[model samples]
Target: MSELHHYLELNDPVAMVWRKGNSQDPFTDRNDLLPVINGIITLLEIPSSQHKVHIDGMVEINQELYNQTSALLPEQFLVNYANGSIQFHPQHEGATFSCKYKGKGLILYPASRIYAMVRRHPDVVKTLQEIIDEAHTKLNDTHLAMDQVEQAIREAHDASAKASMAADWASQAAANATDAAHNASHAVDSTKLLFKPAVSDMKELLRTHLNPQVGWTVQTYKDGIRYRYDGKDWVPIDIFGKNIQLVNEHTDGLMSSSEHSKLKSIPLETKERVIVFCLPSYLFQGVQNIVARFPFKGEIVGIKAICGVPGDTDSEIIIEKSMNMKDWHNIMSRPVQLDAFSHYDDGQAVVDRATVYAGDCFRLHVVKQGLNIQNVTVEMIIKI
Candidate 1:
């Protein structure tokens, strides 16, 4: 029988050859290139040479070397298999070969396949590292921004609190200034009352001529009149009831006379024209009658009186003043019947009286008895 030649390819670009004869002598050239055949053939057994002499090479693949070389290649050359195994194609200058390996199997794969599969691991690891680094940087920036926002919030709160406190302090200061201004205004008004030019002169005159006790100072001065009193002066402090003339130094001698007799007798006249100043109608309860007499003689030709009523209604009173004891002059007379005492209800009526006189030593009378009297005020004005 003749012999046959066979070839086997290996992953390292090497081929192995062997010779085979009939079945009775299968490996006829077993000693020829047996080692080289083992380096290429992946199977252990030879092919059948029953009727023909077959020469085939047994390829022995060095799985370790294939894996080491394949690991050096890039992942682009490696393919993923459906069975959880990897297949790699090794392309060298114009030649290419593919080899497959199971993940759990001990079978060796081609060096190119192993190199391509292993090379992808490093790229994946590097990509994952880059992703992780980017994530870390982004997280750090976010944290920094959050810190800045928190700081800004704290500062804003502090500034708002300070502004609120400042506003409160300013409000308090304004209120204090307003209160101080009010108090100062009141003090100025009081000082003006104490140093009024006319009232001060009148006080000095009273102090010199009247022999009044000390502490009899004027407290209120208005409308050409002064209200004065000592600590113990309780005689009502009325200028009219005292009967002494503040100008002519004469007393009203008819003050003790009965109303009927005074009504019938002619009152003494004043030579110098006298002026009687009273408070406003609202403050008329504090009004005082001041009599100033003069020396002269003339006929009683005129009689006039002024009466003031505050917030008067139709039911108010009208009183008459008389120059001659027999004749009455209607100063505030009305046709309708009026309440003669309406002024007493509000305490807001003032009566000022003057008479054209015919003689010196004028007499004046101002009387009030339980807010009612025959005459509230009587004054005589005489010619000079």
Candidate 2:
């Protein structure tokens, strides 16, 4: 008979039992038997409230009872089952255990090691769907944000184009306005020159107004002299005598001279009004030439002239007005031939002279004329 003792190793998940004669040495050098120990612990049944079991010193059991208990052992722990007998041998020094199977080897492992041998399983569809859904949502948000950004850029480009066009139009409009203003100013200047009088009018006035038959002669008065014209008609003395001095003094004098010499002397104090005439038929249409001069400002009113040649079918009358005295533009008239003395009265159809400011200057343009012909003479009547 033998006594048995049981111990469990918590860190190794193994249980061991020893059987010895009374006073036998304690078991040792049996660590390699841990797997076999765990297998035995799994095969035995322990009695307790929560399946706890303990090993106590026991002498022996009946042979029949030991054999039945041995039958309950796991397959790896049974040896010589067909013989209906069990034998134990010590494999390590001071160990009281033997291999349960004599020729075959069995190794037991911890529960954790068994679990490690199993493969892991996961829900593939669930994970893939979550990933896909998140991607779809992010893509949709990105597309929307990109659309907003593009729209803003388009709006900004449109606004810039509109502003550029407006600026171009404004610049063009300013240029046109400037050109129109310049043209208007030129038109006004042309009108002014057409009405100015020249130096020739003063000489003509002196010739017409002063006569010898009238008293107050230029030969009798040099500086200042009074002359008797009639009973109560004694005129006062002046530079341009009452009437006769003007005819005598200006008739033979040099108009361009700056000094008063005997041959070119003129009364320095007196001024006279000049008159001239222009006939549209003989002057403007017949000889095709007209030129006159005046002293100050005046207007052309009428023309009177005598004809030298007989009236012909080609004769015509054309009156042209001009802002510049050199270039005449058309005003009014009809076609006629002159064979005798004739008159052309323009009436209110006149070109009036304008006053010039001190520092300002003006110019006139003869834009167009009534008739186009070769030769003509125009006698103009001007009032100053």
Candidate 1 to native Cα RMSD, angstroms: 56.1
Residue-level lDDT of model 1, residues 1-384, one tens digit each, is 333332346433322233334355334222111221211222132322231111211111234655677542422232222222222233322322222121211122333332222255355333443555678999999999999999999999999999799799999999999999999976654343222223433546455536544334342222233444433451223232333333222333323235445555765753455433332222111112232333343433233333344123222332343344434443322211213444333333333433334422332222221222122222223345
lDDT for each residue of candidate 2 in 46-131, tens digit (9 for 90 to 100): 11111111111111133465477663321112223223232222222232332211111112334332322123465233333345
Q: Write down the lDDT that model 2 would get.
A: 0.36
| Worst 10-residue lDDT window, candidate 1 | 51-60
Scored against the true structure, residue 77 in model 1 reaches a CA lDDT of 33
Best by TM-score: 2
Q: What TM-score does candidate 2 reach? A: 0.19
- Write down the lDDT of every candidate, Cα atoms only: 0.36, 0.36
TM-score of each: 0.15, 0.19
